[model samples]
Target chain A: MSGEQTAAIESDIEAAIREDHPALITYITAGDPSLEDTKEYVEALDCGGSDLIELGLPFSEPIAEGPTIQAAINRALDAGTTPARFFELVDELETDAPLLVMTYYNMILQYGSEPDVRPFVERAADAGLSGIIVPDLPAEEADPLRDACDEHGLDLVFIVAPTTAGERLDRIMSQVSGFAYVQARLGTTGARADVSNATHDSLTRLSAYDVPKAVGFGVSEGDHAAEIIEAGADGVIVGSALVDLIAEHGTGDAPAADALESKARELKRGARRGGEQRNGHEQGREEAPEPEQP
Target chain B: MSETESNPPAEDEPNRERTFGDYGGQYVPEALMPALQELEDAYQRYVLDNEDGFMDEFRERMRDFGGRPTPLQRADRLSKRYDREIYLKREDLVHGGAHKLNNALGQVLLAKYMGKERIIAETGAGQHGTATAMAATHLDMPCEIYMGRTDVNRQRPNVYRMRMNGAEVNPVDAGSGTLKEAINETMRDWATTVERTHYVIGSIVGPHPFPRLVRDFQSVISAEARDQIQEQAGRLPDSVVACAGGGSNTMGTFHEFVPDSSVDLYAVEAGGSSLEIDQDEGLAPNSATLSTGTDGVLHGAMTKLLQTTDGQIVESHSVSAGLDYAGVGPELSHLVDTGRVTPASVDDDAALNAFHRLSNLEGIIPALESSHALGFLEEAHEELGDLVVVNVSGRGDKDLETVLEETENRDLDAAPDVEVFDT
Candidate 1:
C-alpha cells in the first residue's frame, strides 16, 4: 500500500503534465480552524482540479513561512494541532489529489526520542501520505530523512531556490524525488503582486533534471500560475491566496469552501490556457519550413 | 608591530566539519544556502587564512577602538568571601559594555572584506544589537537590528544605544515577542537580502560556519584569560565558570582551556522561577538548556532545546533577558554530553542576590547573565577547587532597573536596604 502511495505522487504529477494543463498544487495548514474543516477544504481543492495537495503540519517555529502562512500556522496550533493530529487528518482526508506533508525538520526528527527519522516517515506513509517537504532541511542534511523516506516508500521532495547553482544545485537535484520545488524568488513563502523574472531562470536551470519542477512562492493569482507554466514550470503551488479566503470566512461555512474551490478553478484554468499557448507555439515552430541550405 | 613579520600563507582547505558530534547542522531554508557558502568561503579566506591581513587589521582595530586584552583581575574580596582564589575575566570592559562586541566586530569586519554593504542581526536584551550597531558604524556599513517588541519596551536604554550608534531597529511582534521571534525575523530578512547583506549572529549558535565562526572570534576571551591567569596565578586555574545563554561567553571562556584536562569547565544556566515546566502552557520557567533540555532543532541548529515531549518549543523564562532562551549553542551541548563540561543552573533569586553581592563586595556591578555564574559560585565554591576563574560577561548598567525592582519585591540576603531611599 505504501509503495503504491509512493508511486502515486510521481504518477499524479506526470499525469497532470501529460494533459493540456500544468499540475496545480495547493497548500493549507492542517487543523486550521479545525481538522474537520481541513478535510472539507482538501475536498474543495480536489473538486476544483488540484493535482496535488500539501497539508502543512505546523511547527512551533516556522522560519521559512512569511506573515500569511505564519498566521495560518498560529491558528492551526491554537486549534491543538500536533503530529498525531496531523496524521489523523491524513487518514480522514478524502481526495483524488496526491497528499504531501510539509513541515520543519524538528517535527520529523523529534517524533520519537530515539533521534531518528524513521518513526515519522513510516507513520506518514502508513497514514497515506505520498511525500514529505521540509523547508529547513537542505540537501546537505537530507540524507537521514531521505533514507527514512526510501525505507518507508515515500518521496523526499526538496525546494530549489533561485540562488541554487553549480555543485549545490547538483546536490539538491540528485536528492530530490517526485518533484523539485522551484522557489520563484529568493525569500520566505508569501504572496506578491508581480511574477518574478527569476522564475524563467530557475525553471531553465532545473530543466536538465528528470524530476518535475513545480514553481512556488508569491504565486497568489491565476495569472501568476499562467506565467509560471509559460515559463516552463510543470506545476504551480498556491497557498497564502487560498488561506486568505479561509481567514476571511470562518470554518464549516459553505461560502468558505466555495471561495477556495472558485480560486482553485480559476488558477487551474489559467494554467491550462498557458499550457495550450506553449503547445501551440511549439507545434507552430515544428510545422514551419526549415531554412534553405546555402 | 614587527614581531616576526614573516608568516607563511594560510593553507587552502575547505571549511571544517559542520557538526559537534551530531549537534550542529545547516538546518535552514534552501534560499540561505548560497549565502552560507559564500560566508564560509569568506570565513576561510579572511578569518582562517588572514587573507590580505584581515586578522591583523581586526586585532589592531580591536585594540585601538574596541579595547582588547581585557584585564583578568583577581577578585580579592570575592576570593576572601568564598575562601578561595576567585579571578574575573573582565569582558565587561570591552566596547559596547559586553562580550557581544567580540563576535560582532569580527563578523562586521569580515562582511566588509566580503564586500557586503549591509549588516543585520537579532538581539534579546539589545546587547548584541548595540554591539553590532557600533561595529557597523565603526566600519561605515548600513546596519539594521530585529529585536522583540517586549525587549524594546523592557530594555529601552539598550534600544536607544543601538539607534544612537546609527542602526535601524525593527521590532518583531511575532509569537512571544522575544529572542526566538527576533531571530526568525532576521533570518527572513537575510533570505531576501543575502546577496548584499551579512547577518551577524549573536552567539555560538545557528548553522555551520556561524557557530564555528562566532566561537573563533569569541575565543579571544579564553585566549587572553588563559595567558593572563597563568601569568598572574603561576598556573592554570582548577575550574573555569561562565554563564551559558546561547553559550557564546561560555564557549569563549572555555574553548582555550578545553585542552587542559585539569581545568574543569562549568556552564551555568538560568533556573528562572523553577525547573519544572508548565506543560499545559507550553512554558519552561527557566533557560537551563544545558541541564534540563533535550535534543531538538531551533534557530537553524540542531541543539539542546527546552521543548515539550511532543516537540513543540516551549517559551523559556529567566530574570535576565539575555539568558531567556529556549535553545542553546550546539557545541556547548556536545561538550556537556561528552562530560567534558559540567552543567549547572542558578535560580532568579540567587542570581539577583549575587548581582547585589558582587556590587557590594567587589565594588563592581555584574550583568544579570553573568551573575548566574557568580550565583553558582556561592552554591558550589567548595566543590570547585581552591582556584577558580569566573567570566564576567558584561557590566550590569543595563540591568539596574530590573535588579532594583526585583530586589525591592523580594527579600534577599545580599540586597542593600532600599526602604531608606523610598522617597
Candidate 2:
C-alpha cells in the first residue's frame, strides 16, 4: 500500500480490467449509516469485485440528485457519516484496488483544501486508491482543488458533462490524469432507461482527448455496460443501479451482508459485457437539450 | 359524535398521498424521507376518523379563535366603479391576519396529533411564517421559521410577530435572499433533520406531500366560501378571485368552486412589469407562467416552471413578494394546462395601486399580493354585474410601507397600458 508510484496507478487499472473480473470501485459514504460501514464496505468491495473503491463524502445539500438518492443519503447521515470517518475508513481498507473517492465540492471547502484534503489524498495513495472524483467540480474549477490530489501523487479525476465545451474538454484532458468520469446527462445522477443521444455526441466529441473516459450514471447491468464500451467509452460506471442493489441486500448482519455481497459480485459479472453493443444505436449520435446549472 | 370516536378513515388507512383530485405526494430530500413516511401514515389515519368532528372544531376555532365566517364585507367603492357588486372574503380578518392561518391551523393541529417535535416552515413575506408560529404557539409546540434576509428587511412587522410567538426565525442569505432562497435553506435543513422536524411548507409547491397537505388544510376556505357566499347572496358568486403565490389559497378557495364553472374561478399573478414581452432572463424577467409558464419539473415534482430552452429555473420578481415565485403549484399548472382555469396578472404598479386603493377607499389594508386579485376587479367586473368574490388573503399592514404614493412607480411611470391585455 505504501510507496505507490503514479505510473503504478494507470497500469493497475489497465491490469484489473484485463482480468475476467469487473473492477469494483467501493462506494461508502464518508460518515454514513456509520463510518464503520465505510471501512467495512471498502474492505468488502476490495475483497469482492470492486477494482477501484470510491469513498463518498456526504453534504447537507447534494444538489445534483433526485428524491430516491436523497433518501438514501438521509439514512446514511442519520447513522452519522462525516469527513474524519471517511479518512479512517480509507486508512483501514489497505487493499490493492485504487481507491477513487467521490464527493461534491462544498464538503472539501468545509474541510479545507490544504492540510485536511491533501493528507487524505496522500492517505488514499497509501491505502491503494488511484484517484478522487469530484463530479460537480469540473477541470476549470479543478486547479486549486487539484493541487491537493496531485501533491500526494494521486490522480485528480474530473468529470465532463454532456454539455462540457470543447475547449474545457481539451483543458481537462491535459490536466486530468487517472480516468475521467463522463456524466450521462446534463443534470444530476439518477436511473433511467435508454442512453440519451446527447451522451453519444459527447463521447464522439471528446474522442480526440486520450484519457480513459468512463460513462457513468444510468448504466446498469452488463448489457448497458457493454453497450457503453461498444459506444467507444473506455469504461462504464454503474451507480444508481448498483446503489439500489446494495441498499436492498447490504442492510443486516454478516450472513445478510454476505448474501448482499454475492449479489453485488453477480452484478459485476454482468458489468463485463459492457464492452459490446447495447440496444440498436451504433456509435455516436448528436444530442442537444442539456439542463441548465448542473 | 364523541371526538375521535367510531369514525374511521374511508379506507383501512389514511389517504396518505391523495388530495382531492390533484394534490399530494412526498417529493423531498432523503433526510426528510423517514419523517414524510411516518407523517403520511399518521395524517391518513387522523383525518379519516376525525374529519367530520374536526370540521366542527375547525369552525369553532375559526369562529371563536379566528373570527368565523370572517365578514363578507362589500367593497362598495370598488364595486361602484365596476358597475357590479364586489365582495371581499375578508380572510384578512382571521387571527394572525391572513388566509395563511386557515392552512397553518389545520397542519399545526395535524402535527400535534402526530406527536411531532418541531414545526419547520419557509416564508417570503412572513405572512405564512407568522401564521404558522401562531398556530404552533396555541398547540404549545416548538416552531422554527425560515425567511430570506431580503424578506425580513421588507416585512419587518411580520418577522417580529413570528419571533414574538416564540418561533425561531432563521434568516436565509443565499440565492436572491428571498422566498425561493428561504425554501432552499429550509430544504437543506429538512433534509438534514427530517426525523424530528415537520416541514410545514407555507404554499402549495415543493414535491408531493406539501401540495396535497397544504391544500387539504386550505380546502376549508372554499368549503366555507361556497356555503357563506350562497347564504349571503342566495346564489354562488359569478367569480372567485384570489392572489396566487404557490396558489394554495386560490386553490383552497377555488377547488370546491372550480367544479362550478358558472363561478368563474380566477387566480391573478403579480406581473413585475409585464409577463416578459421579450425573453431577457433574470429576477424581473418578464413572468406570466399561468399566462405563459411551461410544463416542466421543479423543486421535486413535474409541474409548471418559468424556465428557458434548457430548463434552467428562472428568477421571477414582483412588487408583491408573495406572488414572485418562478413556478406555480401543480394543481394550478394542471388547471391552466387543461383550460380549467383562467390566469391573469397585474404589473407592479397596478397591484400597488390596488393595494393603496383598497386601503384608502375601503379602510382595508389588503395584502399587496392579494391586491393582484383586486387589480383584476375592473376586468373581472366587465363580464357581469353578478356576484364577485375576491379572497383578501392577508392584511396590507405588512405592505403599507412600500405601496404608498411612490409605489412601484418606476415601472408604472414609464409604462403604457399593457398592450397584450386587450379590453
Candidate 3:
C-alpha cells in the first residue's frame, strides 16, 4: 500500500488503462468447451499480441454476473468443470500468456480457493501470466491473493468503476499490484454494440490518472479495440466475444483446446493493435512541442 | 451491463424507487428474482385486500395471545429528571417477552394464508428465533431456525427455548460468527426450501416485500402511540426514540411518525465503550448507515452496510447481540441517509450505566438493547421535553445473565429481578 505497486500502477492508469491510450484485453472462460481449450485460448491470445487475458472459471450461483456469464458457467459446469479442476489444469499448463483467472469466492473457499491459488499463480508467471481478476471476491476480502501476488511477484488485479469513489480507490489500490482492471460499466459481465458515452468518459477520466488500467467486459472487434485504445485504455478485454468464438469453433471432442487457441490469436491481434495505437498516441502527446510562446 | 427500467412506481412513499421512501426495493440473487417479483406482486394485491379480515385477525391474536395494546407508561423518575414525558410502549410485556412476537404472528398468519408448508427463520440474538418458533408452533407449522454458532452460545437460553418449542435449530459457522452468518445460512436454506418454506425474516433486512411487510406488521406500535399520546397527553410526542437492532421496534414506531414532519424519529444504536472503543466494537461496529450508507447493499437486501473497499462485509459489535449486525434494516438506512431519521450511538459503558440507572430510578429493568434508547434519554433528554416515545422491545430476561454480571450487587429497590422483569 505504501510503496510497491501504487506509484507504478497509477501512471499507467491515465494513459494505459484509460480509453485515451488503452490496452486491449481479451477473455475466455477456462474449461468452457473444455479445460484444454481454455488453456490453449489463453496461450493463443498471448501469441497473437493481446495485452491481457481474463481466464474465467465457471461457478454455480454467480449472484453478480449477468446472463452471458451465467450461460458460460452453465456450459462449463455441464462439462464437469470445478474450481479445483480449473486450478489443477492451470497448474499443469505451460503458457506464454499473462493469465487473469477469475472465479467466485465461495467456490474458491470451498476448494483451497486460497491454497490452490499459489500454484497456478507461480505457474501463470512461468507460463507468462501478468495478473488475475476474480469479480465476486471484493478487494477488501482479497486476503491470500494480495499476499500471494506479493510473494510470487504476480499481479493481483483489482476492478474499479465509475460508481467507485475516491476514498475507495485508495483502499482498493492499496491491495492490488500490477495494473487495475477498470470495468467498462457497473453490473455483471456482458458485451453490447452500443456502449455508453458516460462509460467512455469514465475510462477517459481514469486515463488522466497514473495507474496502468485495463478496460474489460465488452469490445467485440478490431474497431472496438481501436476505439478503447484511442480513448486512453491500456487494455481492451473481450469475453463474451471469445466465448462466442469458442462456441462457434468448438466440437464435442476432448477439451476443444484448439477453439480457444484460434480465438485467442484473433483477440490478441486486435488487442495488441489497440495497445500499439495507445502507445503511439501517448508518444504523440509526449512529442507534441511546448506550446509556441503565445 | 445496463440497468433497466425497473424502478417501482413513484408514490408518496417512493421506496428507494421500490416505495417506502429510500426504505424498500428489490435486491436478491437472480435465482430468487422471480420469487421476489412474485412476492412484490402478491404484496401489491394484498394491499388491495386491506380486507378487514387480516386486520381483525391481527387484533384477535394481539388481544388473545400476542398481547394487544402494549401499555404506554411513563418512566416517572427519568421523566422528572429530564423534564420530558418519556413514555414506554411495553412490547416487552407481550407473551413471548419481546416485540418480535408482533411480526412473528403477522408473518406466520400470512404464511398460513399463503399455504406455505414449513417456516424457516434467521436469528441473530435468538429473540426473533424464539418468537418465530413459538408462533409457528402455536400455529402448527414446522419451523427451522438458523443461528450462528457464536450467537447460539452467547444466547443459550433462547436457543434452548426454541428447541423446546419444537423448532429445529441449525448452527452456522460462517462470516464473523454472528447474525450475518446466520443470515447467509438462512438464505441458502431458503433457496433450497423456497417452494415450501416461507422464510419469515425476523427483521426488515431481506429482499423487497420483507422491509415493507415486517414494517407493516410492527406498525401497530406507532398507530397506538398516535392515539395514546392524544388520549393521555393530548398531542403527538415531539420525538420518537427506539433502539435499532435490525430495527423492528424502531421501524414499527417510526413508520407512523416518519410521514409526520413534526415528529422526530431518532434510532439509538449500541455505542460500545468510548467513541474510539465504540468505533472498534463489532457489537454492530461503527455502522453509521443513516449517515453514510447510500442506496447500495451488503447482505441479501438493499440496505446500508459498512463494506470493505472491495465490497466485503464488515463485522459490527454492540453489547446487545440483536444490534450486533453488519447491516441496518433497509428503512432505517433510508431514514438516516434521507434526513428523515436521526441516528446516534451510545457506547456500552453509557448503556450499562443507564441500565443500572433505570433499575434504580424507575424500578423498571430494561433490556441491554433497550438501554441504548435510555442512554439517548440520559444524554439528550434535556433538549426534548414533554414529548418523547420510547419502544421497550423486550423484557430484560434474555439479557439477565449479562445484566447481573455487569450491574450485580448494585440495586435501588432490588425487586428480585421479577423472575423476568415484572410490570
Candidate 4:
C-alpha cells in the first residue's frame, strides 16, 4: 500500500493455494450495526483466517439481494451509510488481507461522472482499496470502468452466473483480473439448503481460464464451502451467513467477533480439506506447508 | 433463391444492436443474463419470424379475444373548444379496457410457445396486471402479479378482478411501494424462477429485447389508427398524442406515424403538481423523465429517470397510477434527443379537469392516464393543422374509487360550510 506496489489479488490467491489452502472470502455491510464496529470486524475477520474481505457499501435499493442482505443494507442505510462515509471508513481501515468494495453499478456511476470515465475507480484506488465488484455491471457495459480500473492499478472482478451463455462467458472472462465470481445458484444471494449441480458444470466451463474463481451465493456452511472448492473453485465466499451472525449477536458484544472468527475458521478448514484432497492422490505434486488455523 | 434470401433481408430495427446512445443496456445481475439471452433468441425465432405462424396466432387472439381495430371516434364538442379536429383512437374499447392487453396477450402467447408454466408482471394502476391475468386465464396458465402496497389500496377493484381471474396478487412494501418497487420484486422473482417463468413486462422500459419486443407488440395501435385516419381524414392526422408513463402507449400510438414526416408527435407526461417542484416532497410531477430527469439507469435500462444527484431513484407522484412512474422508455428518450417527439407536461388538476370535461361533453368516462393526453390539447400550438389524433389508452372503470374520492374532496373544498351527519 506504500512505496511497494500492492500484490495483485490473483497473486494473493496463488500464495494461499501454494500453502495448500483455498482462499476464504467474507462479505459484510460496512455500516451495518455501526461503522466503527465495521472497521474492527474487518481486522477480526482477517485475523480469523479470511484471505480477503469484501465491504458491501449499503444502497437504498438492493435489487439483487434476498431478505438477509436486504435487511443488513436497510439497517446500514438507516445508520447513515453514504459513499463518502464508506470511502472514509476504507481509508481508515488497517488490515493485512486484501480489501474489495462490493456495490451496485449506479452507486459508483453517481459518485463520480466524467466524459467516458469512472471516478469511483480512481477514488477507490486513492482509498487504498485492492479490488471492486459491481453485481449489476456486466462485461457488455464494463469497458469504461475496466479502463479506469486499469489506469488506477485496481482489480475489476466480474461474475459468472450459472445461466451465463458460452459467448457471454468468454466476454466476461476476458477483462476480469482479481478473480471471477461464480454465483452458486440462479437467484439472488441467500442461504439455501444445497448447492446446485449447475455450479460444478459452470466451473468446468470456466476451468479453461487461469484466473482464480470464488463461489458465492448460498455457500453458508463449511460443507457447502468444501463442495464448491472440491468442484474446482479456488475460493468460497460466505456473506449472508456472516452478516446474519452480526445481526443475531449484537455488534457491541465480544461474542459477535468471536462467532465471526469461528465461522471464518470453519470455512478455511473446509477450503483446506478440499485443497488437500485435490492433490493427495498425485504424489508427484509439490508438498506445501499449511497455514495455522484460527 | 428464397424470397427472403433474394430480398437481402428487411431492415429490422427491433433486431438491431441494442443501445440508445448510452441508455439501454443489460444492467441486471449476472444471474439473469442467460435468461435474457434465451428470451431474446426465442423472441426472434418465434414471434419476430412471420413465417412461423406465431404472429398470426397472436393477431387472432388480439382480434377474437381483445377486440382489435378499436374505433376511431370524433370528439366534436372538444374539437369545437380547442378549434381543431380532434379524433380519439378509442383503445378503451379493447377488452380489459386498456392498450396494455396488446403487449400482455402477445407475451403470454410467446410464453406458452416457450413452454413456460408461470407468468408474472408488475403493475401500478393494475391495468397491466389485469390484462396479464386475463391472458393467463385464457391460456389456462398460472399467473402472479406484483403491485405496490400503496397502489393495491387505491386500486382495490382491479385487485379483486385479478384474484377473480385466478391470478395471485403480491403486494410489495419496499421502497416507495409503487411501480418501481414492484418491478424490483418481479425481477427478483424472475431471477430465481427463470427455469419455468416468463416475465411479461408491461411497458417499453426495461433491459434490451424487452423494450424492443414490447414496442413491437404495441405498434398495432398506431398501425390501425394510421389506416383509419387515412381512410377517414383523407390523410394522416397533423398530430398524434398519448400519455407517457413508461412510454408504451405513446410509443404504440407514435411509432407508425413516425415515418410520416408531416405528422407531429407529442407525448404528454403526468405533471403531478409542476415539473419544477422538488421530487422528494411526494407532491411533485411524475412521468416527466424527458422534461425534468437526467440520463441514468433504472430498472435495468439506461434512460431518463427521476433520481437524486447521488443516483438514488426518486418516487414519482400522479393522480393516475398508470402514469406515475419515475422513468421513461429508452426509445422515447432517444426520440426526444433526436427531436422526433415533443414532450409536454400536464399537471394532475388539469388532467382531472379534462377527465370530467370529456365525460360530461362526450359522455365517455376516460381513464386519468388518458386524460393527460386530452389535457395537452389545451396547449397545442396555434399554427398546427386542424386534424389531431389522441390515443384514449384506457377506460376509467378501474379508477372509479380514486375518482369518486377526489370528486368528494373537491366538492368539500368548494363548500366549507356544507356538513352532513352520518345517518
Top of the candidates by TM-score: 1
Candidate 2 interface RMSD (Å): 15.1
True-structure lDDT of candidate 3: 0.67
- Give Cα-based local distance difference scores for all models: 0.89, 0.65, 0.67, 0.82
- Could you tell me the lDDT of residue B120 within candidate 4? 96
Q: What TM-score does each prediction get for chain A alone?
A: 0.91, 0.78, 0.76, 0.88
Model 2 chain B scores worst on lDDT over the 10 consecutive residues at B1-10
RMSD of 2: 19.3
- Binned by DockQ into CAPRI classes (incorrect, acceptable, medium, high), candidate 2 is incorrect
lDDT of 1 by residue, A81-143 (tens): 989888987988768788999999989988976667889999998998888999999999988
Off by over 4 Å in 3: A1-294, B1-11, B14-24, B274-288, B291-295, B408-423
- Candidate 3's docking class is incorrect
**Candidate 4 on A82-178: residue-level lDDT in tens?**
7888999999987877789999877788786532336788889889888889888888778888788878877788888888867888777766677
Model 1, runs deviating above 4 Å? A1-21, A251-255, A288-294, B1-15
Q: After superposition, how far is residue A13 of candidate 4 from its true place, in Å?
A: 6.6
Write candidate 2's Cα lDDT for B1-423 as tens digits. Answer: 112112122433244533324322333433344455566665566654564466566556767777766777777888787877788888888887788888888778787777778898999888889989998998799999999898888888888899899999999765567877687667766654555667787888876566767777777777777777777677788888888778988888786776666778788887777676343333345445678776544554446667543233567878777787877787787777667788887777777667767776788888878888988885556864478989888887777657543443445432234333434
Clash pairs, model 1 backbone: none
Listed for each candidate, the true contacts retained, as a fraction, are 0.83, 0.00, 0.01, 0.69
Q: Where does candidate 2 stray beyond 4 Å?
A: A1-294, B1-26, B51-56, B277-287, B408-423
Best by DockQ: 1
lDDT of 4 at B41: 85
